[model samples]
Target: MTQKRDLENKDGPSAKKVNLEFKKEEIEGFFNDKIWDNKFQEEIKEQVEKSQPYRWGTITELMNDELLRNVRQEVLNEIAFKKKETDIYKVHQSGDLANLSGLDWDDLSRLPSLYKLRAGIYSEEFRDMISRITGSGKLSGVKTDMSINTYTKGCHLLTHDDVIGSRRVSFILYLPDPDKKWKPHYGGALRLFPAIVPNVPKTDYEVKLVPQFNQIAFFTVQPGLSFHDVEEVRADKHRLSIQGWFHIPQEGEPGYIPGEQEATEARSTLQQLQNKELQEYDFPKPIRNDIPADELKLYRGLGQECAFSPEEYSYLRKYLNAQYLEPKNLQRLADVFMEESLVELGGILNDELAGKLMDSIRDLEINTKAPAHSSEIHFPWKCAMPPHKQRFMYIDGKESLEASEEGIKFINRTGPQELPNFQLTGKAATNTVEELFCQICSFFKSIAFRKWLLFLTRLIPTSDQILLRRFRPGSDFILATSTDSKLARDNTDEINALLEATFNFTPTATNSKNWESGEFGGYELCMSSNASDDEDEEDDPAIYRESDPNDDSVLYTSQCKWNSLCLMLRDPSILKFVKYVSVNAKGSRWDISCQWNVESSDKDDEDEDAATS
Candidate 1:
């Protein structure tokens, strides 16, 4: 039998073998003179110590120019990268470089430049200086983790605080084309988000570092406070980098503390649970409950064969296409909705109304500019808060939350306690978009539509919350995760929510060529709620990747399109999100998002009968 030893402690044979690989002088030139110079170390250390959002720093011209350039070329020539996407990032990645240690000598010899770079990064000279500079305590020499990643056009990393496992310091060494300068306008900048509270990050970023070739950016891994992300690469270029971590010392190693690692892990876990509790305070508040039987009957009395009276159809004809209002087409659509719990209807509006809407929206885009940052977005449109959860522009008939730490606390106190009344406030006809949106919301609340929906889905909606959303190009998305089960639980005695709807009012989102394969997002996606025995689902579920495309979980994916309406039954465990709208999208994805609390008569009455009998 083979024996296992504490390699992490640096006492084992593995440590000795690694120690012999690189000499101090060969790798000393890798760092800039200022970094190692005894005279300048204190100045740099002080700067890193004082930095905001959280303590972090960057160093330019890291590694010998010739050696680093050679390493970049060798990597491009030797490696195959697979697209690795998760809730965190979308990037092309090479296999972990740490695996090199397991390869035979011959295989390892084939990658001489990489071996040198790895050894240089872990050198005693660099390690001690990094430890002292970041005040991160001693880092382990035996357990190293690293991999190469390339962020190409449309690639991005969302907000996360690196607090997993034994990692003490997280670092990235950028290697864009050595010969060409990386411009700031090209996107792919590393942005740091400051905290509103310990775990809650402010909506906007405080610091942004444009990456350049031969630059190294790093920060000590502080749970909750160290929030950061890679902005999407907009230009058609690759931002390649080596990403890795330095770990706290392991058993028997210098500066090793027996309980420190476990303590850090426990604290991170506890903070995550606390963070979830804080998020609960931010969800959309709903008013009322399932409409009473008498109230439901009021809508049902509108008549059986169709929802519209002759006069109502005449009024609706001004906007809706007559084909959709035709009896045959309505029956077909209703049948489809009954079985699938979903229906996507194109040409939802009459050409005259469609043309007016399209022209109006196009004019709005050209005349009144959209905000570049979420916070800068004007009222009527409010920025969603604490971007760690989601980022988008929306109108929910409630006061917008301020974007500061105190603002978050204030908003939390006001609470989304009551369901909103868009119709009450929406009655004031303002701009074209507002008028159209208000019309839609009011129509949803009408007796005729309620009757129409009841006949189609066989579920009576009791209450609703409607949001007019503008998924501005480049900066809007909702991360994957479901809402609280309790929000919809009373409708069904079981856990699932009965229904939800999104009326896509986008007038110019039909980029069928791009969205067909999801190459450039702007699609709404939902999956069947995960089963109980599956691994405990993450608080923030990982983004779905094509590599492991949902075998059967994906319930529906509605591509960006104009005048399309989608309705679906909601499952409490189901995860959903609006795929981040790409900067290159035709225009903002406009939609009226609605959540419904629905109940069915036969099922409720049958259960009541059983109880009485």
Candidate 2:
């Protein structure tokens, strides 16, 4: 046994004897200068654009008899034992072919020849040339970090964008069929797509490329729309490639600045936008009915204003009655309004308030069941238009005659006895009655509610104001409006009180028509403040406060699945009620108009021309 072991050890090859005969200087020149020629660059670019998703090729000259044998052996020895996922040891295969990745020397590895080649390719001269050609200062002198995936018979990668992180450019160096041309029928074709939008594009727009040895393909990562997928291999052949990036390197590189400050700032802004609360848009639905009794009560009374301290509103003499109005005490009220388990309400509050709230809800239900009064109409006043456009109307029992260009018109309503019109010159008309009320409460706390009462006086004509009435399904349609200026001053307080009172006595049912009309389908909450006619028109009145159709000024609006709920006041003077107005919208995935700027008008005009032509 000892003699056999000695003989085996003597015959075994030493580690040093297996070192690669890689010509570092030669390989570096190939990547840095020789690989990218005018004809080759044009061909690759055309192929990438033609391919629906991605296109890549490899350099054939480097995959020669001596170099290929030595490189393959070194790869199998040095990389096979290392962590497979690391940058240095990547195994790539498409069909039967496979190769190791990341042999660059400037990285952690000490392979002298490989290091020399990597340095040469990433040298200043090469990067400058690239910068001149691509017109991107961001890519000059970029270092690449990449990993490889080996594919067998059924192994395939689905279509996806390689846009994650800060990848500026992507390229693949082919090593398959050193002598033979990689034909289109071979199945390992790189595909690219023309971007229709940033992320989504026409699926049929695609191009393909059949790679050859000693060839490479590169392209920019166009976020959103640049999507590509690998086609499955049909034949049993191995395809190999060296894929890498031209990174915007750390500190010492040409584009690198003191601390990467700009990149950091951009990332922070993106995160903030992503974390903001979804605005309630169209439908108004209860968002937090499951809160604890006390908490719910507080939230119900204060709305979003609960976030502020009482000290903030000390200027106004109103103190929150925590006992009755705080969120903690409102759970019972919420449950009752929701028509949920009565037993649960009893556990949260003494049977007293719970029973009272429930009774009020039941009363509202009873009123709803009574024969439709001559004045009452369904909640949603109009059907929505496909793509963009929503309409809502309310009719009350009271009647008012208005002199228009046509003639005197008598309008009926039941909600308020008068339309509370305050001369709000720059204010958004679509701001919800509740949101305006909250702002008033927050800002005018120091000033007596009566002092602010004067503002609403200028809003509407005295004759029109008298036409307002309380919203009554049976007798009121357009006749109801608010005449009390003082009550209007504390709009937030008044609206909350009204809502609480309404919830106490009214039980709102899930409108069957609402469900059948596809109102709740695909609903999602979103917010927009731009004064776009298309967007404003798409809002549902039940959830959105209808703004003055004539007002084209910009105003912030929150939307939910049901409708849009907007806060009209922009004055800093009325900031007090900021938290009080909590707009609720139903949860549904509804389509929203993407028109936000004046550019959409051009598109509209073009569309009109097309139709006319």
Candidate 3:
């Protein structure tokens, strides 16, 4: 018997005029009768198990011939002129995936015709049949979200579940070919994975469903278990489908409460899992250890040790752009420094102005240094030292100075004339805390000292770069101005006040501390919420918990030192002989270091000898 005729006549009983009231009763009766049928229940259970994803597929012939033809023509027309990007359309609805709804519905429009086709498939009669077969009662108020998905040869969708807010059932109506089967090799097969766990599963078990014209597939969104993906299309063909959901109706409708509750529970569980995963991957490794050896070698080749080649210059011009100044401009600056005395004079001028001119120069619009000519130049310019080998130094900024037998060589460029000189300095000294602080102060006051300190700190041998600490056993706390104290507490307003009072410069606190230090010399830094602390923790909820002293953890020691140095640098009222300074502490012990390279324009010929002495 025809499906339509069977629905009209029940149990061989027929009437001249079918009552609309009787139709509702008939539909409800059909659903109730199938609710407990042992064979039907077994069919569903077997399908859910054998399919492994609780989905079903069926092909309906000539559902609506003329509408189908028009829709096919429209899809072809859209694809022929489509841009090289993904496009989507939605039927109107409100919720998390609301972008998939509220499409314009004029019959003459191509999209509205597609929408009508979707509405027909999700019609009251069809939904009632689905509800009866699935043992879900009295289906009414079903809404479908339909869209045409055209996947080019390279396009594919990554795995995701159709589960969304208030979605009960998900279905896809296929329109591929009216005469031929949509084969697996075409690479648009619907792939489904059985749920073993939330967000993670054993990938050995999976199933594939190839499409045929007028075929439909439906499944329940079983939270994380129902993972699916669209296989990338291999052939130059369009895979069109009207995808949608069967939703529970608004309040006062039957069967609405149960469906709503099911959706709520599923969404809540998914969100909890998402939050937990986010916290796990927050802090990445500090060192670039994961980079491959070949890549690292390539990066090292780009250092300052190598001379710039034509190709390198071209690349720098293209990639680094405006940062690379014209060769003529560099020559002009070089010509101004023709006299050796000018180099020394510039250093003396910097000392006379103390910090004022240095601060102004730093803030000046002109580009003082040439663009790094090659990767060889990068080593000398490495501003922040690695966590290991971080310590204080003092030296003269004389470019011609020779290295000691310990391989500590100093090449100074105290004046702006010559290229920035560097030295290969040996290990740091194990001086007393007071002596180290004194050296730090002297280094900041002397231009020659600044040059040597800058080079030595950056050139420590890789093997000897063991992390160091200055520990004081008795004293557990250090004293500083209220400004410095507020920084440790992360008070922005106080930090700004300190900056203004010291350097006469102000910057917004958008950039956080780049490095941090803790007990036993642990150090690391990056833009992330996760970092280790050294001090003891209290019950204050506003402050982050401190690191455990007993347990060894790497703290961002450089960040702590940089913060101290930045505070000192901001004060233009102080000496300007140094370009950088940092402090390191463990327990009560602390070491402060300063570094600067001179600009030649500030020195005089007579001052050169005194400066070197």
Candidate 4:
């Protein structure tokens, strides 16, 4: 019965063409005219050429203040934004503005300033001006991709060289609180990392720019050397910006080199990281298992239901948290483990011991300055090797001392290594902080704990690796990996021997609430393996996100919390990683990660053996 009125005067003779001329001066008013001035353009060009890590540049007051301020207001008033968290970033993103052409006039009227800015960005005068300065060549005016984003407290983006299917340039124009200055200490700075080689980035960053309203930052999309991250925002204020890319021209467009995009993809960071020679550095060190005869025998006999022996219970009473010692709690955990293949136990340590450990660690973190280099950390605090896959402080039961470059080279060059049996479990002799951690590492290797684990999961360890890990803020993490390094046996579907656990020792202050919004950092995430049969054996999940997290593939995830112990009877198909601890994290995410070569009891094999008997 009702019809919406069209914005067009359909009966008018000129309605079909509707050429309302937008003057050049109107477009010029959208940006700072000085940017197009020859002298400034040359300065910008030279700055890009000399930039560290890779070529990149930023211009403050890039757009006229009033116009950008109005654009920011329009965006905040009209756009719906949602928090999107994935492996690479945590940000609030607006719907992509790529289809601005389809917007009804009423909607367009509300976003007029945003349209003006977008148009100015793609205007020939601006595009060519950017091309000549960055030497990126001409850009495609028909293909614009941009979205508004707000990174409030805790939001961040991990390091990545933006070499995806891109035409040419990557850019971000900030629209943070105009009246306030975005300070460096407030944390959301654009940080750039240098490369040690063409594809490998140095552990630390060399360049950073604090965001400010009306500032525009851009970089040529180099394959690997352009490693960068958006530091977690720490202030109460929001750091809003518009980010997108300019593609190399499409067909029928000025800069369309026929095979340019394909050639660029060939040299993409994803491609570079997948190179054979480069994979020698992937982490979760190449260790395999060699089940001891005695350990294998214990596993076979443990059967469907098992429990800690009286002596083993007594031994644990002195060390473990009282709650886990309760038979009911242990039984509940066992039931869950049997059903889901994973379990979480809270209050896993005795209060007195936990208090002492907490006090000692707090004192150490406050008093003992952590070493500047991985090699500088003391014996028991050996740093995990290879920055690409993971980097954190850890001490193995074998007490792997600080790794040397030469030793790392040896490990990488050597073939698959064997996991150590608990032979060194009792070697630790002291009670100092250094020895305290070693003692726990040894405890993980102890026959009593091994027996308890067997009673709980009916899984026996052929060999074990215990690590005391310390993830400092802004510093550590493990990228996901699938180790089908162990062969699937007659009794199992996958190499399900990896019984892994994380005994979180983070203080009460850094619970999920502090980082649930993900600003403060230190969360543990797990996903189903992304490993493909087609990719080479050397391929592992990229330290980057392979796909959107919303895609149903993520299996389970947890954030850092105090006194919680996580157990996963993992198959080689399970991929796991600890999210990077932001520099803004209140404290280190401390934990003991234990891995065992477990022989889980298979129902079919047990039934066959029983029937035969």
The local lDDT score (0 to 100) that residue 570 gets in candidate 2 is: 17
Candidate 1 per-residue C-alpha lDDT over 1-613 given as tens digits, one digit per residue, 9 for 90 to 100: 3222111232323322332355677778766666778656677689899999788988888788888988898777766688865434678877667666554454445566777888888877888888888888999987787888899998988777777667899899999998899998888999999887777777788999999999999999888788888899999999999998898898988989999888877656235734556663343433334555687666534444666778777866766678877777888887897777787778777888777777878888878767877657665567765566677787776655666666666666765644455665465545687666666666766655666666666666776667788888877777666666675453344324747778787766655675666666768887655522344532222232222345576767787778877778876667777777778776788887877777663465578899999
User: Candidate 4 residues 152-221, lDDT tens each?
Assistant: 8768777777776754898999999999888888988998987666676666678889999999999988
Q: Which candidate tops lDDT? A: 1
Worst 10 residues of 1 by lDDT: 3-12
Candidate rank order under lDDT: 1, 4, 3, 2
Error of 4 at 591 (Å): 1.1
If candidate 4 were superposed on the true structure by all CA atoms, what would the RMSD be? 6.1
Deviation in Å, model 1, residue 244 alpha carbon: 1.4
Give all TM-scores, in the order shown: 0.87, 0.34, 0.38, 0.81
Please say which candidate is ahead in lDDT: 2 or 3: 3
Candidate 2, residue 228: Cα displacement in angstroms equals: 2.4
Residues 1-613 of candidate 2 have per-residue lDDT tens digits of: 1111111122323333332333545544435344356775455445444544433333345323444434333333333221111100112421111111222222214233333434544556545544444443566454444332333222223233455445556655555656677676665666665443333332332566676665555565444444454444445575655555665546666587564434533332123212223111111111111213453233233321123245533433232223333434444443343342111111222344334534543444444442222223322111111000111122111222221212111222223333222223113223233222223223322222212111211111001111111122211111001112222223122221111100111112133342333222211111122323374342211111222323543122121212211112112111110000001112111111210000111233467899999
Best by TM-score: 1
Q: How well does model 3 score by local distance difference test? A: 0.34
lDDT of 1: 0.72
Model 4, TM vs. native: 0.81
Clashes of 4: 6
Kindly report which residue pairs in candidate 4 clash with one another. Answer: 154-519, 167-248, 321-349, 321-350, 474-582, 474-583
lDDT of each: 0.72, 0.31, 0.34, 0.71
